[model samples]
Target: MMMSRCDAEEDPSQTKKRKLCPSSGLPEEMVLSCLARVSRSEQASLSLVSKRHRSLLTTPELYKFRTLLGCTENLIHLCLHIPPDPNPRWFTLSLKPLDRRLVPVRSYFYQPLDAASMVAHGCGIYVMGGRIGGRASSSVMFLDCRFHTWSTLPSMGVPRYSAASGVVDGKIYILGGWADIVV
Candidate 1:
């Protein structure tokens, strides 16, 4: 006699359980962590392979597992200035680990700059004065990573370009740069 595809053939002598994931032989939670590390682009293809993959890929619990595993994803932000366009445009690209696929994000900072000093504080990227039309600039711009917006901060004492800047203990420090001082 032949059984249907959905039917499970069983024997009274065989009571042992079968492994869920054939590749890893790990628990479902551990398996999810392994799957979470895969790039987002591949997750869609992997989902098509099996029902288990689809469930794990779409569920939020997989992301929770990623957090538990301390997998911190880093995003790369790039600022571009094109001629004729007055405002500088900001773009962000997300690079997936292991797979190394680039995913572009919608958010951006609306500010134009030829050269500027950038410093990261917490979740903010601060843009200090840069050279504009062969002159030093003192305009301070702040880019908030959380909301993906730009705001102006108090200008520095002097206009500087290509200045050195850093963040320490939540404080931002701006050092000497190409400043035009007429004595």
Candidate 2:
């Protein structure tokens, strides 16, 4: 809402004109293009620019557009766990935009699954069954490394811990890690 389009009133005494996006006086598509060209590390900082910019950056369309424009880059994710810590931590190597280092991702939304099997497929990392609270879990979660987000997948038929898994020809294969209870 550059003007009075959204009914959001501005000071009548002010005479300055407002463009589409206050940050960049460009169209939405062009803005997205420019943002797509920015390094992954800098994207998070850009999100603080404005609500519109943050929303636009989070959408899947941004990455798709980046791919179409050949502006994508390689990113590495590192996961580490040490004794005395309840869960493992995830980090990504940030190699651009003035600050280049391993940046920590806020993974609270999707708590780490201890001993969970992980396999990389395209832009997603699948976390298969593992122990949750010292008990076997049947839940499956998918992590979109692009945005450091996670989504829950259908739970497995049987709970598993320390499962062995992999991707074969676009299909996932899980072997072992389930047990039967006998009364």
Candidate 3:
């Protein structure tokens, strides 16, 4: 028996037709724009859709959203060297978001602080005083966002942790409960 052209194109075992492209469900441009507006975490998931979708999501335009979220081009800088004994060396890292081409910034050995916190405002990242090896500190470091340089600033009144910082007017306000209490 001879198979007809239509019969040859159709699979006898498969009743469903294969989709040419999932993109037909949504306009490519629209989908790209929507993905750009979402968070990096969300965009990461969208990139898994297919090779085409992943390509669209990796564009420079879409990747710029990471910088726009928490940092601007002018508000990013590199830091080298921390403080307080131990490993005192300078390191470079950007607080800004990054694209696939760009690498995440590294942290410098600022102080022998067990852990530190950072706040970005007015094109600068204000690192409030932290505990050095579990000891309270009064040292503060500021990075000039535009220049990518580091400098020391006035210390916080007290060493703190789990602290929050923000910009009010032109000043950085550090507010939070201290890790240690003095009786």
Candidate 4:
């Protein structure tokens, strides 16, 4: 049974409160609802609290609540071309209590700086249409903010990476990053 304050046998004269959290014996749904109010950066740290916390932090349900509650923050992710490195480096603007700064998001994926056409939609950054090895890249990469995971969507039949791209009406539009088309 999920524990609640009412479930506890309280001494009438005693005034003490018990800590209730996902790891502290609260119902999984309740814990997720509470945690959803917190920011993603803090949520990253909260995952270290325990095994239960770590698991709960990665659930899509938490983010769904966050979206419904309008608690989601705008995440600014930038990819800059730093010479000497073949691929660009990715960094995200981290918002913390009273202190805001850009924090590097360590990505394991290799995205070509020149050929990749990227766009930010909802909680994911879609990196698509790039030149992998001097050839058109058809791989569409998705980065989920909830868990900072890199996943692939269905591959496109043609390379569509370009400087001009956007997400309109939930659809991704790419123009000009074709291997054969030099712009």
Candidate 5:
């Protein structure tokens, strides 16, 4: 019997084997649901297990699922002043499954923006009222943790640097700082 071009190719149904996923052979959807329940702080470790896990852990769908399931976790971010570097570096402390160590996070910096007041609220770090080019500035910027991006917000009424800021009842209050005295 002569074999035709189509006959030489194996039937997909016959050659394909059922793939048992790493999650006990459960479907991808179910695995994602279980993984989504993990605290966001620990997702980095999960992401290192495999490429599939990394893809699933970092997807927007998984984050949305976490929100829908009420599994969101809050992280504490701190700006550390390292010697020889005037610009402060941002770090986040993981909570839940609780990690006390600080993990470095990405942030944008503009020269001469030191002494800015920073406060965290609703998945964002607000940096407001700082010195720009060695002069008092009223510029306001926020870093969105979810997207790791920076955006500008309305500037404060007056330029202030080295101010104290904190969140009270979800409201950010900027307290006293050095202000430019006009002649």
Candidate 6:
């Protein structure tokens, strides 16, 4: 007996059978809508199925999930690059309830020459020691939101880069980092 086109088909070398989509049939838009409800990772996977599927999966409605869920506000720092450079430009963003827009607090424009270790607490930002053009910098810059000014403070223990910092009980703590030797 001959099998119909819609019937399961098997390869001559294999016993397993495979099913095929009905001819002239189209995937329901509801299916894509359902897929859009999945997580971002899953949506990205669905996009790989086909060009049309990719387009549907990456639509603004689907990609806006992060922003709608308030996840984007948790990001503290953003490293942006202007291109043509191997390193990314870094900027610290303020996510305080009073401040809705991301603020460019600090950057690495003078990196290798001047590097800062910054920590934000309350409404203020603290930046520690850095070097300028291979010379150790003893300057400490602080940003006062209330005053909206950058002021110099007491210098740090050492001039460094790639350092970590945190605030505890209104005091800033500086952690491990490379210190430049001044001649």
Top lDDT model: 2
Q: Write the per-residue lDDT of candidate 4 for residues 1-183, one digit (tens) a residue.
A: 134596778584432353356447764667877888887656656766887887676678777878788887766677887788777877677655554666556465755446688888887788887765566777888888656668879977776556578988998887765565667
Task: Rank the models by TM-score, top first.
Answer: 2, 4, 5, 1, 3, 6
TM-score of each: 0.51, 0.72, 0.42, 0.63, 0.60, 0.40
How many steric clashes does model 6 contain? 0
lDDT of 5 by residue, 1-183 (tens): 112486587677844453445746665656767887886666666766887887676566677777888887677767788899877777778775646777665454432268888887887788888776778989998887764457888989989999999989889999999998889
Cα-based lDDT for every prediction: 0.68, 0.76, 0.54, 0.71, 0.73, 0.51
Model 5: lDDT to the true structure: 0.73
Better of 4 and 6 by TM-score: 4
Return the candidate ranking by lDDT, descending.
2, 5, 4, 1, 3, 6
Q: Whole-model lDDT for model 6 versus the true structure?
A: 0.51
Q: Alpha carbon lDDT of residue 72, candidate 4?
A: 78
lDDT of 2 by residue, 5-53 (tens): 5776768555344235556776576677678888777776777788888
Candidate 5, residue 31: CA error in Å?
11
Name the runs in model 1 displaced over 4 angstroms. Answer: 1-73, 80-88, 98-109
Model 3: residues >4 Å from true position, as ranges? 1-99, 102-112
In model 1, the clashing pairs are 88-111, 88-112
Q: Can you list the residue pairs that collide in candidate 4? A: 161-177
